[model samples]
Target: MTTPNESPKDKPSSKQMICENESSTTKKNDEGDNVGGGVESVDGQNMSIDDANETGIDDPKGQGSSSRKRGSTIDVAIQIGSGSGSGSNARKKREMEIPRGEPTCYVCSKNFTSWKAVFGHLKSHQRETPGALPPPTFTPTEGSPENNNDDETNPREQLAPTLLNLALETMQKMSEDSNMSVVHRPSSAFNSPFWTTNSGAPVWNNNSSLTVGARAFFTKPGGANFDRERIPERVVHARGASAKGFFEVTHDISHLTCADFLRGPGVQTPLIGNFDLVGNNFPVFFIRDGMKFPDMVHALKPSPKSHIQENWRILDFFSHHPESLHMFTFLFDDIGILQDYRHMDGSGVHTYTLINKTGKEHYVKFHWKPTCGVKNLLEDEAITVGGANHSHATQDLSDSIAAGNYPEWKLFIQVMDPADEDRFDFDPLDVTKTWPEDILPLQPVGQMVLSKNIDNFFAENEQLAFCPSIIVPANAPKCVYHNNHHEGFMNFMHRDEEVNYFSSRFDPARHAEKYPIPTAICSGKRDKCIIEKENNFKQPGERYRSFAPDRQERFVKRWIEALSDPRVTYEIRSIWVSYWSQTDKSLGQKLSSCLSVRPSY
Candidate 1:
């Protein structure tokens, strides 16, 4: 019988015999034959070809159906292939295991089966000395074995040319358009055109102010045109600074909310923000629900008779609504007199819902934290700053942007699951309350950077209006308003049924027709409209308790002094006593003791 290693023209070489021995120690080879002959076993016994068949062990070499004894030792001569011995074997093994395909480099066009080979090739192409040769041009390798161009045009190259041609054609067409050259007439000088009455009739030669022969008959310009240049200031947020900025989302909260703005990172929405401290940081107030908003503003505003704001008027108006006490704590605190707009924080001051793509609604509250951190000026600082410049905040915002030092505010929202709203110590939907960051953590949404200053104060800043109703891509879930009849007539009368139409009509199919419906529909619910019921009082109470015992005493003393004012009525003082009692019983007792009055139930 012919042996496996025996060739047609050559006797089996010693190296071949050793290889056959090594193969017999392994599994069967390619052909069905036993080829083991030479090679010493571990026990110093040479494995012979007959030993493989005698032991009845399965073929050790994968080449053939030969069998050998287990643990048999074999000696084999090592053979070198065409290239590096071990390295060439490894390459052959990998090539056989890994399917062959065209090689491509992601970074550079240099292609090689091994990246190390590509690296060596790249180094050789580089000039040895600095500036010794021109930069290697990335020419399209054509007809070289490396280039595999199957068609006349490369798809990417063809796309580039087509886009360039289309762009050029668009530019040429735009150049020929008549609208491109249209000119708009600019407004003439204010007084040179002769200031006119509201009727538009010119009032010429007004140097003497409508005088009778150099003797002034009418002192003012014209009674009718005198007040034309002036308009009524905003009822609230009257003293404020306006800034333009973009709200960019930095967090991925798509799972917790359906609001498009908080869906992912890098989404930006245009915003015009206003900061005010007519009496508090939280302007555009959400008092005891939406009904009390107009009334609260009316009470806080300057009296119609004196045209001067009096603390007595505000205290009396809010006294009936005991919930106003929570807000009063903030308004009475040092934060009420922030020296400049930059130092104060902003809050939505209402509970809103975050709807996710799955239609899950989570109660949420928006907060704006200054990147510079909270720094409030004391009463003395406010007196000095306000006296020095009434427009200090506006000037600061404008100058900061111009100097390339933009002011930034990080936007965060405290979210609570709707089912867990009642689990908190305070109501989440109450406008009079504030969320405690310790319990319900503040999740960062994004940042607002005021980089650009408005060009026209009147056209851009003054005329711009912002309502809580505006819904952008990232707004929270919708809200419903409900009212109790026990609320006063002023409050109950304002329970806007037309506004809270969503709850009445549960059909979402009708939503498209009412897509742009104003937020006016849901304005009457007290808990939903007022202090965000979730996370409100706990934060204030913690803030109050954080003060040293002595400081807390001083705070109660100050409150008592304010409440004990002779102008403040007994009922108002009693209401305040109860309010502080709810905040801290000891605080209320101390205040009542200082006022020299028994604590009212």
Candidate 2:
């Protein structure tokens, strides 16, 4: 090895060098394939055996030149320093040297004259026994500086090219063994294996919390990166899996909406690093009004005191909201418990208004019909499956994609003319009711294919939030309206403008031209009450009737199980029985007979 301060001429010239050659041993394995016991040329390149032995490069195989293991070689070639070359490549090689440490191998406790020589030695060890040990978990002791951190006593002038290659390969191996990744920090970028409290100030020790003087749990006033460790979980649809795919436009509905993503036929909307069609398994929501959103979530969530979800508590809360009865039709059905995310249908529960470029408004509901057809786990199956593996759903989706069996869904939309809103007995806007498929046929729009699985659960699924709110409409014919109100908790938008509000000269956001405003009149005193046309029982009854007798029996059995809860109030049971009677007398009578109670109504 040549020192940095040494003159190029002091190093042996190319003519004076001779390469040592080593031949690898090969033998046929049990599988009748020739396996080399020594290094083989990578990428089918014609590599000189002499070049390999001279550089002391151990082949990835567990064999090398006998002289390498013994550290004795006389036919080594000398290489000129990186200074011999011009441009950034030379500078990069020079920068790779260990800045201030003695060229020492922490693993073998071997010291070399230069960083390059040390790295070459390390590479030989790695190639000899790949994956024999993990990367250094403990930080190596810092070497005392000989002078200022920049000065070095050793010269690194000879075999610079070979040594640089060895250094890079060894460093790469270290990164792989350590499971390191590049992360952007505020001060400077660095390689890390785990996420810190914040990227800017990394928590070198993540196993323990930041404490005061290593005794108390109180974090150092500003030292601990514990201020913002978590983002609020979504109010609903919190548990879900997301995927990457594209939404292609099959048919043009330019007259319906002006959404840029649906501009024309054959238009594709990329879901990765872009927008997502966040939806649930069922086609409708528990509440139509956003005001009831919080209360509805509270009722569905585990009880505040016990932290356990009880059907009795859920029933008591939703007993008053008859509108929820319709949603329960699907929720209690066999499909309520899915085998996995891919097996169910997705829906944009709310009835959204789609305005065309001509300012004509139409009410549309988005639907995703799974190409696999709807399949649900039976109640007993759900218990057995969930008991076996809570992450079975997530695993199934991942495994399917890995096996090249990409899940697909066909997109369809139900359109209703705003003028025909009151044509049906049920409210068109009621989320609890699904428009009769016979009346409003599902018009084909497009299809979506979940082709890619997310890389990180927390970074992708946990952090991902979608709102019917985050819409972007262009001047395209099918451009749709944008509604973005629920912006809180882990909102990851970086805005750098003075005015955050809209309609300003400096602001870019503004209402689009020819956007149709709903003409429905709003002339009512402020009141808090259920929707007047809450015909929730009718839909549930229809849904119950649509099911086969066996399916209906299962549905009633589920209801009976819920009504039999020890904590369920008699009044609540009576009210529920009365509601079921309104939907179907037979269904009501069956529940009453099972519960040993007379029909309330």
Alpha-carbon local distance difference test for all models: 0.51, 0.60
Flag regions of model 2 displaced more than 4 Å.
Answer: 1-232, 272-278, 471-526
Candidate 2 TM-score, C-alpha based: 0.56
lDDT of 2 by residue, 97-211 (tens): 2212234565687766544356457657767776544354333233212232332222222233343344344344333433222322313333355544443555544322233
Candidate 1 has a TM-score of 0.49
**Candidate 2 residue-wise lDDT at 533:** 75
lDDT of 2 at 378: 91
318: Cα error in model 1, Å = 2.0
Per-prediction RMSD in angstroms?
Answer: 34.0, 20.5
Candidate 2 yields a Cα-based lDDT of 0.60
* Residue 202 displacement in candidate 1 (angstroms): 51
lDDT of model 2, residue 449: 82
Error of 1 at 150 (Å): 99
